[model samples]
Target chain A: MNLTLKVWRQKNSKSAGKLVDYQVSDISPDMSFLEMFDVLNEQLINKGEEPIVFDHDCREGICGMCSMFINGRPHGPKQGITTCQLHMRSFKDGDTIVVEPWRAAAFPVIKDLATDRSSFDRIIASGGFISVNTGNAQDANALPIPKRQADAAFEAAACIACGACVATCKNASAMLFVSAKISQLALLPQGQPERYRRVQSMVAQMDAEGFGNCTNTRACEAECPKGISLENIARMNRDYYAAKFASEEEV
Target chain B: MSSFGKAFSSSIGKKLVVGITGLFLILFLIVHCFINSLIFLNDGGETFNLGAEFMAGNWPIRAGEIVLFLGLIIHIVQTARLTYENRKARPVKYAAYNGSANSKWYSRSMGLLGTLLLIFLIVHLANFWVVSRFTGIPTHDVNNRENLFAVMVETFQNPWIVLLYVLSMVSLCYHLLHGFASAFQTMGWNHKKYAKLIISVGIWYSIIISVLFAAMPIAIYTGLIN
Candidate 1:
């Protein structure tokens, strides 16, 4: 297969960036999008040109690092899949693909197509955990969480902190990401002790990090590799409002 | 507000304000659309004009308008504040890509559309209410009643004015299409079983309001309803 790639290129975070075009030939349809990039890079290196930089640690889609906004849609034309999981078969010969970094002020470009997603980390760190020290870990039967709540918590916990939610969001809001974090902790018996504080802290961090407010678009869930539910966002809203009102009553 | 303090204050407060205010606006749209639909009743403008006059002068309607205004303010302010705060949060993006196509175009463009709707509302009120009340136009019909039909017809006759009205109504529909379900979800109404129901309701509500409202001007323009 032959393809024309218009990839976003930036020297650094402080410099302005633009899409640079490159052409590759003899690509196999089975090659993943990242592998195609590897071919492009190999050619660039052989010609003594700077290899296009992108992020992808595990090509298996587990690491949530393979990010690309291929041909206008994120992760190419496939739905509910990661870039690393996307294969060249999804495209045709003589296709001109336009690739760019996620367009959000929150996610500044580091190089070519790589963004600083540490804001997501900060949101997670804010209160996306159960800090109760069980020392060596609790017995499996210690506290019985209802199967429903446990499952819900697990579902919410599936978020891999991929900034896809932000990148896909028009406002670049991280409400889906933040809500998933809050819902994970707010759903479980083990996460109950600090439920209010957990939502409050995580949401606060999300806001402080410049993520936009959730308009309940559910685009994040649609594009999520893990298929995270927007229900998590609703739960987070309920929890956060409950905590706010409860705290106000205490005052 | 300090970063943490500001965020903490806005998180819950902003959602509540936006939700409540959004619901109020939705209610207003429904009522407004219903009243406007009465023009189709073939009463020769008597019933519709009477209703419009009543709405403009009735104490209850006046009070409702005030409440609607307050809701608009809360909705706009909270949206602006939350948007500003969220912009400050991430400051960066994730490494690998594949997440943009999942969302609706309207969902992402709500802020932009909402701002346009706000501008439209100001123009709408100024043209109809202000002219009727203070600008010294013939308010009453042959029966000494406010001839709202004439006002509406005259107002919608200009191609430019009708164009603006159509554009604004389109913006309003887009805003509501995403916003309706969002308000429901924010209140924890996101059961998978009920998700389709909420989405359908959002679509219907948006369609009804936009079509009904925009139809008034088009109807007048085409002489379908005088």
Candidate 2:
């Protein structure tokens, strides 16, 4: 199979960029999207042209590193699937795919389709963790958390810190991503100590990093490879308000 | 503290200002609507005439107008400031993209609609109040009541002006619908069991106010409920 690719190329963060078209031939239907890109890079290298650069580590879907806006939807046509997991069979022989780097003020283009997603790292650093003391590993049965609560926590934890939610959101809001991190921690007993502070800090950081406010539009969830629920956002809001009260009480 | 300092000191403080100012503007709408609804009271002559009389000359009414003007200024200024802050906070990417379909339409476009509503308000005040007060137009009725109903009738008679009014009303409805629920949310009123119900009620109220306000001019123009 052959495919026409329109890929966004940028020399650096400060440089302007545009979509450049490329043609690839002899693509195997079973090849993963990244593998197909590998084939294209090989062709580019053979022709002495600069190879398109994109972020991908561990071709497996768990890393959340492969970020591409294929056609228009993030991670291509499949729902709840990462770009690395997408196969070339999803397209036809003569498909013209428009690929672009994630265009968020928070995430600037580094080169080609790779973007600097360090803003997400900053938001996490603001407060995406618990400050519990280090100790011997506790028995799994010691906490005895409710099954429903445990399940919900696991679901929230499924967020791979992928910026797909940010990339797909119309307002480029990171509420969904930030909310997922907050919700996962808030749902657990171990995370209870810092729940309020976590949400407030993360949200403040998100806003500080120039992410848009959430209008409760669930587009982030729709495009999220992790299928993170919008309810997580509401939970974050609930926690933020509660945290405000908790902090005041502490003061 | 400076006025700017007061607003920027905290998120909650900013939200409080926006909410109070927003509710104040909403109060003006309720009063304005009640007065206009008097057009349907007593054959479109007696009640409207009396209402306009009070609005134009009554000392108490004059005091109310002064208070109302303060509310309008506060609401517009705070809203503008909040919008500016929100814009600055927004990420540059996906700025042109659409949000989730589940979000309220008004939530995303409030700034645009609010601007249009402001423009309409200026036109409304200029065409009726300013013209009647300063130009010495014969705008009063037999009892020396300001004939606001006549002004409304004349304004709606022009199809182009009526079209503008309709568009403005539609935008107002959009603004109110989102603004209503968002006000409650900012005040931390998120009891899920009742949150959805309250938001639905907000939507209904918005629709009713918009329909009633928009209907008045259309009805008068068509001579339906005269």
Best by DockQ: 1
* Candidate 2 residue-wise lDDT, B1-226, digit = tens: 4433422343444555566667777777887888888886647566886876677777887888788888778767866765665565533443123343334456767778889999999988887778666875566666666676677777778888777888889998888887877666655465557688968987887888888888877887788755
Candidates in order, interface RMSD in Å: 5.0, 4.9
Number of the top candidate by lDDT?
A: 1
- DockQ for all candidate structures vs. native: 0.41, 0.22
User: Candidate 1's residue-wise lDDT over A1-251, tens digit each?
Assistant: 99998888999999878778899999999999999999999999999999988988978877888778776566778877889989999999999888887767667789988988887888778788777655786779988888988898888878777777777765577877788778877777778878878877777777677666666767777867777887878787777767766554211
The sequence of per-residue lDDT tens digits that candidate 2 reaches over residues A29-93 is 99999999999999999999999999999888899999998876778878888999999999999
Q: Report how far off residue A56 is in candidate 2 (Å).
A: 1.9
TM-score, cand. 2:
0.82
Worst 10 residues of 1 chain B by lDDT: B90-99
The per-residue C-alpha lDDT of model 2 at residue A122 equals: 92
Q: Which stretches in model 1 have alpha-carbon errors above 4 Å? A: A248-251, B1-12, B77-100, B136-143, B153-167, B220-226
In candidate 2, how many Å is residue A117 off? 1.8
lDDT of 1 by residue, B23-115 (tens): 888988888888888888756677887777778778988898788888888789888987776655535443333334566677777889999
